[model samples]
Target: MNGKFIAIEGLEGAGKTNAIKQVGKILQEQGVHKIVFTREPGGTPLAEALRTLVKYGIDDEVITHEAELLMLYAARVQVLENVIKPAVTQGAWVVTDRYDLSSQAYQGGGRGIDSGLLNTLRDTILGNFYPDLTLYMDVAPSIGLKRVRSRTSGELDRIEVEPLAFFERIRSRYQILAEKDDRIITLDASQELSEVTSALRVQLIKWLKNKGY
Candidate 1:
């Protein structure tokens, strides 16, 4: 693709929404006008339906780890083929709220799924497709959950309702993956909102400069 692809990743309540807005502002300042924003598991009609199923599940029916992971990939492939690919092919920068890495951390680490199985699924389903850059907002599980609780009083989704230990594991996995990958930037999201945004702006700008944006 001629255009760039950026993916934002984080645990729940890591201020990704604000980070995305900051990214947009920075890109605009850098004279990037053709920007397309998307979210994983819900970027298209079919994908949205699958997102709902994966998030809420059927009434009183248990969703196995494997089933959940498969549902995510189904939704993901739909977004990839229908929305992201077309946008990027047309030279529009594609910014996504989440992507394949979410599954690696949440399913592989939190759900205790096998890494080999996860890697195989990713390789088979997505092949070499991946974000040009990934911004991982790092936050402590307790603090992140506190933010979530403060922001919304409604019922939590399936993944959001996961225990603290689960999130801790996911965070650990994210750190591990980010450390190993040059494309992924681990941002400290435990700071205040303003501080987090400031840090994000600096990192994004640095990356943009490196890419000759």
Candidate 2:
């Protein structure tokens, strides 16, 4: 893999949609223009169908935890086989809105799934495959929910509608992972937009230089 995979991960309303653009600009300056951007759950046709099934709260039947976990991995595998891996093989950079870490935070930490089981599933699906750089945007759950509410007049998605406590647990897991992993950098996303953009550019540039890009 000459091309790099950069994943931007965080809870809902953590400004990930905009953060990708910043990362893209920094990558362009580093002469990486063959960039492909992908979002979790909907990067391909089959993945989009699974995303709808996993995200929309339809017919009021609770989606079992086991079902949710399987669907997420199913969508992710589709993206990898159909989109991410192919692009990376062709020497194109990939920036993603979310990736494997979401499951670690949501299913494992938030839903209280056994970490051992999660790791087993992850290894089965992904093995050693992972991002070259991962930016975990850290935002307070209260602030994140408020941002989501103010931006939307309609109902929230199934996971996005989870209570504050749920997101708090997810955030805690993200913090722990970012602190422990050198590749995962935690960014304070509660700052002003310009400040956040500048911070992302600076951090990404530093990492790129360190990698001999």
TM-scores for candidates 1 onward, in order = 0.98, 0.97
Candidate 2 local lDDT, 1-213, one digit each (tens): 568899999988899988999899888988989999999977999998999999894799999988899899999999988999999999999999999999999998899988998899889998898999999999999988899999998878888888899999999999998899998988999998899888998899899989898
Q: For residues 23-76, write the lDDT of model 1, one tens digit per residue.
A: 989999999999999998799999999999998898999999999999999999
The list of candidate 1 runs beyond 4 A from truth reads none
- Give, for candidate 1, the lowest lDDT window spanning 10 residues: 151-160
lDDT of each candidate versus the true structure? 0.93, 0.91
- The TM-score that candidate 2 achieves is 0.97
> How good is model 1 by TM-score?
0.98
lDDT of 1 at 3: 87
Error of 1 at 76 (Å): 0.5
